[model samples]
Target: MEVQLEQNEKKGKAFIDKDGKTLAEMTFSMAGTKQLIIDHTEVSDELRGMGAGRQLLQKIVDMAREESLKIIPLCPYAKSVFDKDDSIQDVLRQ
Candidate 1:
């Protein structure tokens, strides 16, 4: 499945799968002008071990790079990814 992103001013979500069934999803809330607080991440049982959660985080990281925004990974999953990847330090909120 391909990850897709949707966002407005206050919030955003990265998700995947077809039809109305969401195979996985990660959500974030806007913080001030240049940061996003990742608050939630979920992957369906059938999609587990498929790296769907990582895919969503990667998409969010790409979006953050494109928009020049920092990430405050409040969600444990997201924070773990950020902690393990040094390359994402540029966009990590200090």
Candidate 2:
């Protein structure tokens, strides 16, 4: 599955679309130039248990790394992932 990303000055999302419907999404807002505040994550039943949510989050994490930004995972799913993954801590906001 391919993940897509869209962002503006204040907020953004990484998501997957299938046949004109969204299957998974992770939403976040920009805090200044250095922080991305993850606020929500969801996956459709078809994509549940298939790591769709993690794929969307991974897109955001990749962007954070390229842009030199920090991620503040306010959403429960995102927070849990960050808490468990030591390898991705480089982009996590402490």
- Highest TM-score against the true fold, candidate: 2
lDDT of 2 by residue, 41-64 (tens): 999999999999889989999999
As for candidate 2, its clashing pairs are none
lDDT of 1: 0.94
TM-score of each: 0.95, 0.98
Model 1 regions more than 4 Å off: none
- Give the C-alpha miss distance for residue 30 in model 1, angstroms: 0.4
Cα RMSDs, all models: 0.9, 0.5
Model 1 C-alpha lDDT per residue in residues 1-94, reported as the tens digit of each score: 8999999989999999778788899999999988999999999998999899999999999999999999999999999998998988899988
lDDT of 1 at 89: 88
